[model samples]
Every structure is written in structure tokens, then in C-alpha cells.
Target: MSTYLTILGYNSAIPTVNASPTAQFLDMEERAFLIDCGEGTQVQLRKAKVRFSKINHIFISHLHGDHCFGLPGLIASFRLLGRDTALNVYGPKGIKEMMETIFRLTETHKGFEVIYHELKSKSSEKIYEDSRIEVFTIPLDHRIYCNGYLFREKPKERHLNMKEISKYPEIQTCDYHHIKSGRDFELSDGYVLKNSILTTDPTDPISYAFCSDTRYWEEVIPLIENVDVLYHESTFLHDLKEMADHTGHTTALEAARIARKANVGKLILGHFSNRYSDLSVFTDEAREVFPNTFLPKALEAVKIG
Candidate 1:
């Protein structure tokens, strides 16, 4: 299966006329995840033509207004649409209290349950996993409690080798499942046919990492090493790196350096500062360090692998 990422919004600090704050929609391994619900996130998701029902989980990087202000509105919308399934929300420790307070104050009644998964860990840890995908947290260095998520597809079973299996008459169609599961085939005479000789390896698993609103952090290299696609925040140019770090943000050049060190297949620089009229400057600066660096196109769905 392939992974698709849609940049719902990629601006920093606040919403601009052309862009909104940090938000993204990730569709990986048949699972849909909404990452960071900034202002105007629901509108952006609608603009991108994404089905609201597809998203069962929402991940907020931090409690920053620009990163999670739209969450209440989105959850309310889900209720209005007659959603009956439970929603899982993962975020910093205060997220559950923050959201429940908003709902309570607004007298917003929900027809479904909203499960909260609050995180306060400083070290990296696994948060969600299924048969096909596994998600882990990438502890980030931000002003507040924050985390980046890594989505990795699980390894698939080997493909059946019809040519090799046809050589043996005793190997019936029922045995194909066992062979594909990497089990050896044995004959009545005690001769064995190795699984490696009968089947080919499956496709390599794909992975995507979303690192938002963090300073220049090198400790995340091992956690996200060699990912298929990486979306890291680049809120400033190199000239404003001091300010960027001071505000718990990363420069475009620094993001590229992280991508290079981690050996990622591609780097997507986003969460840009509105101060720069020309967005191309980010790509120009990052490409100097990592040639595969690219800028995020808001509302566009990009295939990660």
C-alpha cells in the first residue's frame, strides 16, 4: 500500500490570507490521521476534498494556539455530521482538560465518545499500532510539551512462488498460504524445500515522519532515520536562526541538516514564517544542505511512497 500526505495548512504563528497554521492529513496503511488542528483546519480539510469520516484519530503536537486552536471546532463539526464512532485524540498532558473545558463551556453535546490519550513523556515511545501500521512519538525540543509522530508500515508477508511450487505435485493449493507465510515445504520422503527458494521478498515498508514546532534537535535522528518522507518545520531562514531557536523553532537550513543526517528519502519543509514574501527562499536555503528538500504545497495530496 502507498501513503498519501496532504498539507492542510503550513503557516506559523497565525493564519495568513494565503495560508493557515500547522495542520496535515496523513493517509497511511489504510489509516487516516489528522496531525495538528490549527486555525481554519476544518476549512482546509474541506478545501482538500478529504472525507471527514476517514479521520478517527487526531494528534496535536502542542497546546500552542496556532497548533491546536481549531480542534474544538473540528470536533463539534464531527458531532453535527451525526458521527457515531468514537474519536481518539493524542496530545500533551493538558490536552484532555483543555478540550473538555472548551466543550463544557460551550455546552457542546456529543453523540459519540472522544477518547483522550494524553502524553507527558520526555523519551520517545510507541503510541498507536495496528496490524498494518505502527506509530511512535519523536520527543521534540519545543517551548512546551510537544511530540512529533512517526508512521511506519508493517512488514508484509512474502509472495507465493507458483513456478517453484509447481515443481512438486504433492504441494497443494492449501499449502500456498503456508509457503507465503515463510514456512518450508516438506515431501513425504523427508525432502524439504526452503521458503527462501520458493518465494520472493515483499516490498519494503514505507514510513513518514511529522516533526512540527521544534527547535534544532539532533536527538531525533535515530528515531526517524531513513524514513520515506519527512515533514519538518522551517519557521525561519538561517539569518533568523537565533530568533528561531529562541522561540523554539527551526531554520530552513537546520531542517535540511536534520534530514541529511537522518538519511531520509525526501524532506518537506513547512510551518513557514509569514515575514518572507518569497517562499522559495526556504527551498533555496535547504537545498544547499539536502538536495531532495522541497517546499510544502498546501491542500495538495502528495504520495509519500
Candidate 2:
């Protein structure tokens, strides 16, 4: 199984030639999830060559315009493309009302069913799960009700050792599954074959956390601790700490601090303010605290091991 994260937009509030608002695509275990649908998200998706139909779930961190303004247009575009599969949109409360109002006023009828999951929990909670992945919400401190998301891959089954199994002709094809499940195999001679000899341990499950549009919230540290990748909002430099706090945003230094405290594998800084033309300053300041920090380019995919 492979996991990747593509940053579609990374600007804060205002969209510029080099950056857009908050939007990303998380591809894990062959499933695609859209995180935050800011303005021009659809256009970015096309530029990134993402198959829009593969994305069935859209998660909005908050109700802010920079975080969710592109949802209506994306939904309408889906309808125009003749999408009939059910679409699930998860966000804070009032999201459904806001989208419904827009659709009703525009007389836009969706070809697919749009299901909304309203999030109001202030504590970390599991919101979505499947055979391969589980999604949890990390309550964030923002001006509005905002929640970050933790994407965790489920533990995989042990890999079958084909060479070892080939040596035992009595081990039928149907028995491979049992062997992979850690079951002992019995031969016709009544000899017991240990599962450890037939299969190897699977790779460790990986997790990714997406934190955006929030202040320096320490509560998120425990929820996202030890994640493979942590994509946190760094809207300003440490020099503008007061402004960042007043606006309920995190500075690059603050984001790096949280990443270090949480002991995450890699830290990705994004959601940059338009005031700064040179992003190297943010990287320099963050690397001072967390050396493993990274600044992702738009439409660039980062592989998660």
C-alpha cells in the first residue's frame, strides 16, 4: 500500500499568483480524500491531474471563506459532470444549511446524493473509518468551530512467503489466508508448521495529520503524536506572533514547536500569508526548532512511508 499527500493550495486568506487558499488531496491505500475546498480548488485539482470522480469525501476544517468557498462550485461541477455516486461532506455545524441555501437559491439540483456530517465535538473523536483507513477529528482553537483531521492506516495482514509455501505442496491456496492470519498449518504427516515460518510481518501502519486555520493549540499534540507526516498551518513568522495570535493563526515557529513536542516524523508548513514573498524565512525560522520541517510546493505530492 502506498500513501501520498498533494498540496493543492497553501495561501492564507488571499490567493496570489504563487499560492491559493487551503486545499489538499490525501491519497492513502488507493483511496482519495479532499481536505479543505478553498477557492479555485477544482482548478488546482485539474492542474494536479487528480481524478475528481475518485474523491467521494470532502472535509472542511472550518466555515471560513478561505477554507470552504470552493465547495458550492465543486458540487455544481460534479453535477454538470453527471456524477451519480453519493458524495459525503464533513464539516462543522451549519455547513449543510449554508450549502443547501446556495443550491436552493441557485435552483441547482445535484445528480448525486450529498450527505453532510456535522461536527461539533470539542474533543478528539473518530468520524470516519473503512477497511484500510480511519479518520479522527482533532479539535482546534480557532475563531470559528474548526477541526483538524488525522488519517491513520489500518494494520495490514502479514505477507505470505511464496518461496517457503512452495516447499510445502500440501499447503493449498485456501490455506494461504489462514497462514497469513497467523494460523499454524498442519501437514498430512501430522507435523505442525508455524505461521512465522510461512509469512513475514507486515509494514507498520502510517498516519498523517492535517492541521489548519488554528492558533497554537497544545491539545492537538497528543492526538497527532508520532504521526508519519504533520501538515500544520504556519500563516506568519515568529516576528508577527502577536498578530498571528490575535487572528487565531499559527506562526512558523509555533507550528514547528508543536511538531517537535508531538514527536512527529516530518513536519510540513503551509498556509502562508501573502505579505511574505520569500518563503525561505518561514523555513529558516521553523528549522531552528524542528530540523525535519518542509515547505511544500503547490501541486507537489509528498510520499508518506
Candidate 3:
């Protein structure tokens, strides 16, 4: 199954006329997972034509206002739409307390059940897993208890070669499943044949990492090494080097440097600061370090194979 990455908002801490704050959506198979919930995220999702119902899981990197300010509104809208499916939210520590306080004061009870998974440790943590995908937490260097997400697709079973299958027309359909599972097929004539002889090469799994609003920390590079797509925050230009360091943010050059060092396939730069009216500088800075860098447009959907 193919995975689609949609950039809902690409702005930094401050919002701009043409950009919003940090938010991204990953569509795998038929399910949708959100990376962040910046302001107007639901509207952005609707504008992008992504079905809100498909999104049952929400992940917040930190408690920053720009990253999670839109969560309550999104959850409230889910109730308005009469949704009954359970929703799971994974975020840093104090997320549950914060949500409980906000919903208690506002008296907003969601129609569906809300499950909160608080992340307290700074390491690779397994947050969510299902038959199709697994989500891991990459501890990030930020002002608060922040973390990134790595989505890895589960390894699929081997597929049978259609030509080989057609040649063995007398084989039963049940035997086809076994052959596809890389099991030897023993014919009625007692002729044992190896499954590998009839199968094509195994397909490699694809993985993507969503890292944002963090300082340039090489410690986490190994966790995200060789990812198919690495979406890292590039909130400022190199000229603001001191400011980026003080605020625990990364410049475009720094983001590209990490992508290059990690040997990732594609580097997607986003979370642009409002100070820069033109984004060409960010792309130019990153491309100098990593040639396969892409500046994603707001609400643009990028496919990762």
C-alpha cells in the first residue's frame, strides 16, 4: 500500500497570511494519522479534501500553542459530526491533564471516547501499532518534553509470480496462498519445489519520520536513518543562528545537514518563520547540503513510495 503525506500547515510559531502553523497528515492505506494540530488544521484538512473521519489518531509533538492549539476545536467538530469511533491522542507529559482541564472548563464532552497516551521518557517509545503500521517516538531536543514520530510499514508477505502460478494451473487456490507465503508446494506427483524458485524479489518496507520544532541533535539521527521521507522543521535561515539556538529551533541549513548525514531519501522542509517573505532562501540553503530537498506547499500532498 502506498502512503501519502499532506502538508496541512507549514508556518512556524507565528502564523502568516499565506501560511499556518505546524501540522501534517499521513494517509496510509485507508487510515489517516495527524502529526500536529496547529490552528485551522481541520479547515486545512477539509481544503485538502482529506476525510476527517479517516483520522482516528492524533499525535502532538509538544505542548506548544502553535503545535496543539487546534486540537480541542478538531475534537469538538468530531462530536458535531456525530462520530462514534474511538480516538487516540499521543503527546508529551501533562497532555491529559491539560486536556482534562480545558474540556472541564469548557464543558465540552466529545461524542466519542478520547484516549490519551502521555509520553514522559526521552527515547524510542512504541506509541501505537496495528496490523499495517507501527508508530515509534524519537526523542527530540526541544524546550519542553517533545518527541517526533516514525511511521514504519509492516513487512508484507511474499507475492507469487503470476507467470509461475499460471504455469501451474492445476494448483489449488489454497496452495497459492502457501506459495505466496514462501512455502514449498508439494505437487500430487510428490515433486517437491521450492517457493523461492517461483517468487520474485521481496519488496522492502517504506518508512517516514516526522520531526519538527527541535534543535539540531545528531543523537536521534540513527533512529531516523534511511527513512523514505524525513520531514524536519526548518524554521529560520542561517542568519538567525543565535536565535535558533536560543529557541531550540533549527535553521534550513541545519535541517539539510541532518538529512544529509542521516542519508535519507527525501528531505521535506517546512515550519517556515514569518520573517522570510520568500521561501526560495530556505530551499536554496537546504539544497546546498541535501540535493533531494523539497519545500512542501501548504495543503500539498506528497506521496512516499
Instruction: Please give, for residues 1-305, the per-residue lDDT of candidate 2 as tens digits.
Output: 68989999999999898788999999999999999999999999999999889999999999999999999999999999989999999999999999999999999999789999999989889999999899999999999899999999988889999999999999999887788778989999999988899999989998999998899999999999999999999999999999999999999999999999999999999999888989999999999999999998899888997
lDDT, candidate 3, residue 116?
95
Clashes of each: 0, 0, 0
| Candidate 2, residue 288: how far the Cα is off, in Å | 1.0
Instruction: Give the candidate number with the greatest lDDT.
Output: 2
**Candidate 3 accuracy as TM-score:** 0.96
Which ranking of candidates, highest lDDT first? 2, 1, 3
Local distance difference test, each candidate: 0.93, 0.94, 0.88
Q: Considering TM-score, which of the candidate structures 1 and 2 is the better prediction for this target? A: 1
Worst 10 residues of 3 by lDDT: 168-177
Error of 2 at 274 (Å): 1.4
For each candidate in turn, the TM-score is 0.98, 0.96, 0.96
Top TM-score prediction, candidate number = 1
Root-mean-square deviation of candidate 2: 1.3
Q: List the residue pairs that clash in candidate 1.
A: none
Q: Residue-wise lDDT of candidate 1 within 1-305, one digit each (tens)?
A: 77899999999987999999999999888899999999999999999999899999999999999999999999999999999999999999999999899999999998899999999999999999988988999999999989999999988889988888888999998888898889999999999999998899988899999999899999999999999999999999999989998999999999999999999999999988888999999999999999999988988889987
